[model samples]
Target: MATELRTAAVAGSGAQARPVILVGFQAQGNLGLGYLSSTLRRAGYCVELLDIELPPDDIVAAIRRADPILVGFSLIFQFYIRRYGDLIRTLRAHGVDCHFTMGGHYPSLSSRQTLTTVPELDSVVRFEGEITLLEMVAALAEGRDWTGIPGLIHRRGGDIVANAARPLVEDLDSLPYPERSFAPEIVLGHKALPILASRGCARTCSFCSIHTFYRTAPGKVVRTRRPAEVVQEMQLLHRERGITIFLFQDDDFPLFGKKWRAWAHAFVDELHRSGLVGRMIWKISCRADAVDAELFVRMRDAGLYIVYMGLESGTEEGLVTLNKGITVAQNRLAVQTLKQLGIMFEFGFMLLDPSSTFESVHGNVAFLRDIVGDGSAAATFCKMLPYDGTPIKDALEQSGRLKGDVCAPDYDFLDPRLDAFYQALARIVDVTGWIHGHRALTPQLNWAWNELAVIRQLFPRLPDTDAYEAALRNLTRESNDLLFTVVENVATIFATGKGCEPDPQALRRQCDMALSRLLHERNAFMARHQTVLLRALQQAAA
Candidate 1:
């Protein structure tokens, strides 16, 4: 099946040309690679995907088998660059002479430094990669001059040559759907899938990198695929891949407001016509301002099971400082609407920022507690880090909030002072205990419900009920272990002098004990609610 899929992918007039191999999520699972692969394929390049998280030998074997003339790595996080370096070194050790390259958020912002570190990399495709990579590969494959490619950084003799930046794809509708055929099949258990409907953000939030990278383009150029095209792809997935739960990977899926509603209705109508309306559930990201009661109802009716939102800060000052461009009232309204619609969601919170004080942090915590209702939602809160090319980093550099050159990828998220603040802040939020208590238990509850639904679907015949129940029971125990591990780690971090303390050893042990107890209580709560939670999930599935 894999071979046939690959053959069909390259069976075109352009199949005679040398293939371009694209590596994605070398160590972590991310969405950028999918976009790159889709764009490359659309531009008439045969592409191969390699997930470096697989065994080193497997990656080497795949590279050897594909024998591509050019390779491109898509990086979303800085830590993954080191993994790419390892792959590059391994390739060299095996005498593979393919030209190496990369482009994504990190490289787009810090192109010069990235080019220097991995000189083995022949070039770096900067900014929007679809046009840049397509141009680069065509030039190389056809043995033509490469100087005209706008978004390329290459070495000319001993000097690094950077061409003019390419403008963002103004009409995103022109791009092809992401080549999901290139996605590596990893064990995501219940088949969680990520999909993107659009690119670029409309807001210029201070701590975000999306606006800075896309700021070259005018306001929100929020382009989207036609509703028919999106529905066509969803139908294809349903028929071909058994994907029933899609997690929209768009930064802001509903950025166009009313336009999104129209698209949603069209999408649902299409699904209903195609007989796939009730076959799958989906989720998407939305801004607080984009969501309201009417929109939530439309979304829920269209089979949206979840809607992730960036409720970044709670305090008015924190919101203003982050330039979130939305008020707390709007945030509350959005959350309430989602809850009223019976849609589940995960709200991301940026816990500690530059302007954060004890009072502000407490206020943020209060806001989180109120919304999360004791952290029941599949929500996450973390300290803010300055991604390169964000307005916050630029502002911090100008105001001396950040020291030294910002080009290096070694910016630590846990500076001593920041760590201390987070440590204190976590106390207010109780995130450590929350994570320890809830992380493991919730998935088990979810799995239990899913198994029961599957049984009911296949009832009377009853295929391996004992096996399914055993799996759920084992998963619940495994979840408990994972929670305890988190509790231990958080406690150690808080207790150790290396993390955020003066008394060091004594403080560490004390914090560990306190956190352990907190987690234990949380575990007890999960245990008590496990049956009710599973039943609710079963009911939802029904």
Candidate 2:
């Protein structure tokens, strides 16, 4: 099946190329491109997906070799404009140009502007692209005029034309499952794959663009798949590719609204009907208010292991500023609830957003303490970024506070002192926790927890695992406390070092020492059971 999908495609009248190309970032998964590929293949056109991270020379070489009828580029972020331009220039310079077009959240919302920026792109496919993209390929292959197609922007004659918008996919299950390599990503020893149960977010958070994106298109902003179909896809992947760790990549897993709850309940029922209780585990991201004890208990029994919430801020004022509908109490209650239910959880946090002050920063730290102080999960956060299409970005620009350009949009803090505090805190965390290239502390803890989850499921009688989990939690607690102290001390010093030690090198040394110790403890514990762990992962997928 895998081989057939990888090599399958029926040719069009004029697009009898070896492999039709679709380019995007594939660091972990690129399901957007996956859907486009599947949609085109369903209509009898071969598609190829290429990662944007590949060298320009290599990408050009692939296009030249395939000589595809149409090349689609997936641009998710506005900052990627310059990079895509450089790549397109290279492709054209190398004499490898066909029809160039792009689509994604950023491009979809700002189609004309993006066309102006990346002029080489012949057109832009706005909003959902499955139907639109297929329509485009058919038109291009049969030499049909495509300027009037909905959800497409392109040049006609001497002027750029903006066609009518296309309706969003109303029935998600009516579409085919996203095309995949079927070569699963490895999590500890278990094979993992990402799936989505729904599309679009219902919330209207100020900094978020997901709801805004869906709203611009014509249809129900939020749609879900049939529960039986979702379970059927999972069962198929599990049987065919040995994928046991299912990650639901829903913007908001349909667990909040009254109508959504019915869908959620049916999904749980389908999982039970398929008897997937003890054979697999899954993870999902959802809003905090949805973390109910009773409903989650049913989900937990049906193989739910971890839940991630967008606990963006812990202070009421910060939540207000960020336009998160829930209060600080709701966020705290959700975290506490998850812990009580014995479900592992992680969260998205922003210590500094568009609105920031010294007091708010301190309050955020206290909130972080409330959640991760007990070491139920590791602490991780960053300042909020004003991306291209978010509501906050428009607000910032209107208020004349938008700093930087389209590529790297930013804003000045209300107080310059807070700016200084932000820069200092960023350095500290960047060094000790969230380093991009390397395996940093926070991700280490996350992976360790995931590994522990897999182990507990595979070996319910595995002795000493509880002690290992406890030690891991204690280390996480310690790490969170130290970082909170460092953040507080740094902020206080920026506020004139009130009640803060002025030690500089010592703090850095302490961070290094703690990180080293963390690695040592985790490694020693795993090494002690290396032999057992070796077989654990093998049997997990087997």
Q: Evaluate all candidate structures by whole-model CA lDDT and list the values in order.
A: 0.64, 0.82
> Clashes in model 1: which pairs?
195-249, 495-508
Model 1 C-alpha lDDT per residue in residues 358-459, reported as the tens digit of each score: 556557766765676333353346667777778777777666567534334222232454455455545533533333243333433443334344333222
* Model 1 lDDT, full chain set: 0.64
Instruction: Kindly give the stretch of ten consecutive residues in candidate 1 with the minimal lDDT sum.
Output: 182-191
At residue 197, candidate 2 shows an lDDT of 89
Identify the candidate with maximal lDDT.
2
Query: After superposing candidate 1, which stretches have Cα over 4 Å from the reference?
Result: 1-12, 26-31, 38-45, 182-190, 217-220, 255-261, 403-419, 423-542
Error of 1 at 518 (Å): 15
The count of residue-pair clashes in candidate 2 stands at 1
